[model samples]
Target: MAETVANHILARLREWGVEQVFAYPGDGINGLVAAFGESDNQPRFVQSRHEEMSAFEAVGYAKFSGQVGVCMATSGPGAIHLLNGLYDAKLDHVPVVAVVGQTARSAMGGSYQQEVDLQSLFKDVASEYLVEVNVPEQLPNALDRAIRTALVRRAPTALIIPADLQEEEYSPPEHVFKQVPSSPPAELRSTAVPPEAEIARAAEVLNAGTKVAILVGQGARGAAEEVRQVAEVTGAGVAKALLGKDVLADDLPYVTGSIGLLGTRPSYELMRDCDTLLIVGSSFPYTQFLPDFGQARAVQIDLDPGLIGMRYPTEVNLLGDTRGTLAALLPRLTRKDDRSWRETVEKNVTRWWETVEHQAMLDAKPVNPMRIVWELSQRIPENAIVTSDSGSAANWYARDLRIRGDIRGSLSGNLATMGPGVPYAIGAKFAHPDRPVVALVGDGAMQMNGMAELLTISRYYRLWSDPRCVICVFHNNDLNQVTWELRAMGGEPKFEESQALPEVSYADFAAGIGLDAVTVDHPDQLGPAWERALNADRPAVLDVRCDPEVPPIPPHATWEQMKATAQSVLKGDPNAWHLMVQGAKTKAQELRRGR
Candidate 1:
């Protein structure tokens, strides 16, 4: 049987188990669609309002499923539009494959319609790039290798398929394709970190301090047990970066809380007062949060050797597996109760937690961002899977929510694309259907990417992002209030142009797409809407008309951000003393809520 290049490409994608593809149309890419129309093997084609959003939808799909997501675009402006999503996927290590239809094959590198170097445009973002020059053999080889690199390396990849190749009739080689291997957990090395002499010196310096603090990042996640062990042996209080939220349980007695701009009182006070700070598995981007090494000694250990001492000045740098290093450190430490230090920090932790929890349950006429997150925190089963799309909504969920249970889970579009909230929720529910899945998506974000992706697959499609999925979108009409703050600075607020408050009734759109959707305009209806969504076996969308008046606080804010804090007003301005008093009240509030 003869197959066009487009058909062959579709065949490869089907082999990859890709049933959902998000994209926008272009002249050069028409043949690709035609090829799908021509065959029984048509992959699910979704039309995204914007190209960047499509890429984001892809990453969201990938992050939850741990499978490579596929997206497509035509040359020139269409291809350029994909950069934002591509970068997001690249940074977060989500596997993706973009099928970008390029300038006609004859144009090559010379002047031609929509001719820009797709290779160079995507070079920094993707781990692998392949331009299909051969319609038959080379194209298939490129497709296979690109998928392999993306799935195996856990990075976004690209293939620039020439427009002409899509229309070329060719025969595919006869060979059954096997999916790629799953990434295995890393094996621990048999050696210690920083050598015996360095360890001895580090231990001596750390032991000299009356107040010792620990900061654990995501890189510390795998070594959680080892971290607890070392903290017990060393008597160090613990905190984490926002990305490391789940690295340890929030209620771990020694666990102070999250640190950095979004950090709490327990972490901030300890950091300010500690004579020694130990950083593990985290290269928290903000250097301001780190204490001065001249006053307090700092020691860091990480899996990536290059990260040590790069973010902050360090008295000691230990390079190796974090788990292994901690394992080694556990035995060398002498435990002494720093009653004064622990008692003081623990009080602050308690007081500060209370205030945050109070704001979470605040009842305003319009729904406060806190209420939305708090309600979500309450209704969602402890084991429910949570997926986040990029924006303030995602940051808020990561920061304020308290997740419990051994089987609890959350995935972020660490790639930073919006509009993935709904579709990713769909994918996550499919991945862990027995466990309820809730996707928190902003209204602005849901419009850009997920609207069509959800609307496109209305009926039974078990494979592509699972049609059985259900998600709740916190509908906000404006673009990211967080990025708007960033743009207020001199920096270019990239991707802001994609924001659209579509007038279309999202619930009606969902209905049109064959899924149950209900919009909650008032707070009274919100709870019932969510309950109904949870009860349904088929995929459903609960659209809560979120208050655009309330702005959001991101996980990592800057000194600049502190000035802009308007969502809630405490007893005093956020000066150091004010923070201590105010933060204490916050902690007390959280403690009461937990009870």
Candidate 2:
């Protein structure tokens, strides 16, 4: 029964149904690397170019696969490099288990080489569950606990095993082997649905108001049909938080695209004027987007009881699974025949699409970013998974890229971190190799993380059955989102010179890596470039030189925002006048529409 600690660990992962692991090797974990290489029936280890990207790939795996993603790295700086990607999973509430190698047990407290306080480093991000396997026997119990805790808590967990312990002989206990035999118990899965009485109370609260709006988030991904039913019965217009963007079809008549900063006009209107708010599985933190206090009666449904009223005041808190709660509540509600509210919102959606289309068709000196996103949207194959880096490019993707309900994608979510889109696309392609994967990245984000990670894509491109991945790099030569934020904060663009980036040919870089690549500096070449990349036999990058000066106007702007933008124009900002006019027109139109 004797076995190496690494073997026991691999066996546990196999038992947990983990088929793949993302990792990067270093000298500190030579023992684990060798053991994994020699073991049979072990998880397929996909080595990434960087430890940071390996962890990001893990985050992406969890996002697309809906399973506990497994990733490993050697100790010291290797473990530290995992913090950002682990934090991405933490903020998004995804399950991920990080197995980190540590210095030898004999070297403890001796200031050994590459030694770091991993527990302290991971305390805040992986606080839900973290432990070190101090001895060989503890491996069985620790692995079981860490894996199950990560699943149950829906958060990242870390298991640090000293290299010596990893190489030591061990025998797993009989009972310990049965501890994590399969998926989490059915009780844990079904316990999240609220009691029938709670569902009834929520239904009553929802039925009391004439104008109701439903805002959903990532928690409602599985309850799309149920959400539609609830919205139909209550005459509610549906609005999605960014994470929930793929949940409901964007083309649905009653569905409003995203809410808050990068939201649609209909969504802003829906939240601004609704008499009742029925939030399902969403904790949209922007108070400005929600109806003011006392303006709407609220009912919130969430699996986490602690977050029920954290965003808005709730009259009835339905603590349950979104699908279960909505199913139980639907029968108790009366259907509304009047379609005025929904029709009005739909009108706004129609006008908004027109505005979006017009903007996408806009001609400029440097190519408009929206034009590229629009063309990509039109050409993106069904069920393709797409990701957008955080920046102005995200603004375009959030507003323009029409999401087909079957398509799966994600951003940095609550972390709102940059440099994850390309890594996310890499992970998604690995998880579902048959599906096409694309990343839309701003110039700054492309250089920040996408540049180095492109090498990882090149390394693994030929290994997969179908390597259909494309990175659409926005070569706008500026941190466009930050520049706009600076203007909105009443600062002149002249003083924010640090936001500008030196131009680089991402297409050339990709081509040099043996990828099929093209650069588009004119609108006429955009469609052909996208077509070329989409049909490439290998990974590709469409380096698009986009206009950095075009303003990404928010769906709704405050008076102070308007004033700040006006001030920036007076301060001699190049694009401020254009932005000011755009904002003024939107504000004036909303006022006329009775928003």
Candidate 3:
């Protein structure tokens, strides 16, 4: 039998060592679907419930696996559905290759069913590389380039295969005019190091300052040891950007948890008080959260030269691999004999954790959302991988969850999109089948898509060596994050029509699908509920009835923000009294445990 372009594409993927391709089926992709069966699913077809979930699962797999994630969808609506998740990958800088089907070539301009201008559709999202395979000969080179470009740029790339072209007889790029050939599959590796002169100057800036603060991001994942060594030598406090929450263990004395709005007090203070800043592999936006310009000398090291020094006014920009740049900078840095600043930072971190614990234990309508994460933190496996969805749940995951040991964690960091929480956990499970994966999601997100993905878990859990995938849903009957945002940022009362969420029993849904399930309406039930979910022989859902009014106040909440909240309360917010009481109690913890 002659190999079709679809068969050849799968062969190429296998050659590139792609174990699974997250996808959904449609007639436009019938050729590839048929190829999957003919090839005996060599590169497994991991069917997701939706095209968007497929893209997100790929992003999750790529993020956790440190490899390029691939997702597939059919033309038009299926292709359009992939945009959000692809944008999530692009913004968060995850390497993902989106292989999407297109309408038949003859029918493309005729506006046939499911026919859409895919090239223009994918242009912005897959800006690094976007190609439409017009012939069977274009398959290998185009697909290969998509994967390579995605890995090299750490962004989403795309290949649009027309329906007719996919079923055509496979033909290699001929050794003739206009033919482009690609080399065999292999990851290109390089360790870029900044020039010695720049490294020396960066060191001089560090040595001259009495206080140093280090910020790490996902780019620093490979440089954890170097970051730790540099921090030790410079007597610096390390603050993690949310995306880099798992870059360094939270147990580290000077590792001030996440920075920016969802940041710890110690992290905010670290930036406010530091005389010098070393940003390692983090392009953390929110320059206001960084040290005041001209108040501190700064050095930034990043793999992408384009991102270097863009976030802050860095005196030295080292465009190199974070691990290598830090390695070069470490030796030049003199040990700070004045460890007073380091001591202060560590003390602040300690007090912040204490305050976090107190806040998590504070009274609420039912379960404190913070306590849900706090309980998980206490019992989460040393080798677990955790993901969080954006919302009030993220606030608790950021503050209350303590990342330690081999535990990995991430969320929709740059995009801050909802619905990736459960999908990311599923991807993490596929990436590391031996490890337990947990997702902290809000009720809004669960209702949006997380619940449907539970069936995906149910289908795949038996294949995993460790069947401990937990989706912990914060079951507050409101879009709590935006509700608070309206009060704190917009000075508007919670407009119940838009903010309220229709309540649904997530645990019941999970149980119906033949997975472990538990619900926690009280703080006392949280720890036990987490235990059951984490130890379940299959995937489990923890539907926690968290307090909707428990505010996710920033550690360094501005006076204007507080004023706005007050104004909203005065204007008659639905849960004004509960919001005030919860906010007061939560803030009191920080005050009582002051550094």
Model 3, position 59: C-alpha lDDT score: 98
Clashing residue pairs in candidate 2 are: none
Please report, as a residue range, the 10-residue window in candidate 3 with the lowest summed lDDT: 186-195
Candidate 1 backbone clash number: 18
The TM-score ranking, best first, is 3, 2, 1
- Which digits, one per residue and each the tens of the lDDT, describe model 1 over residues 1-595? 5678888788777876777677878987888888767765368676666787678668766765666788899888898998887787776666788889888877877888788888888878874555544455555667877777787555788888888878888555445454222222222233446687777777776777778888987667668898887677666788877657767776666677667655665676677778888899887767667666476788888756656788778888888777877777767787767567777766666665566667655543355555666666666655666666666676566666665654233444344555556655644543444556667777776666667667543533344343335556766665655544543232333243454355557787787777878887776776677677766656788776665434343323455545434222332222324323433443445556445
Clashing pairs in 3: none
lDDT of 2 at 219: 88
- Model 1 residue runs over 4 Å out of place are 1-51, 65-78, 109-113, 127-154, 163-210, 324-333, 339-346, 406-418, 426-435, 456-470, 475-512, 518-529, 545-595
Residue 287 of model 2 has an lDDT of: 85
In order, candidate lDDTs are: 0.66, 0.83, 0.92
**Which predicted model would earn the best TM-score?**
3
For model 2, residues 1-595, the per-residue Cα lDDT tens digits are 4678888788778878887789998877777787788775378888887888888899888888777888899999999999999999988888899999999889988999999988899888889889987777666668777777777777999999899888789765445553333333222364467788888888887888888999999889889999999988898899989888888887788888899888888899898889999998888888889999999999998987766889998888888788988888889998888878878878878877767777777665568788898898888887789888898888888888888758876788789888888888988887888888999999898888799999889988886677879999988788888888878776565355688787678988998989988989899999988888888899999988887767777887777776776677788876665555554554454455443
Rank list by lDDT: 3, 2, 1
So what's the TM-score on candidate 3? Answer: 0.99
The TM-score of candidate 2 is 0.94
Higher-scoring candidate on lDDT, 1 or 3: 3
Report the CA-based lDDT of candidate 2 relative to the real structure. Answer: 0.83
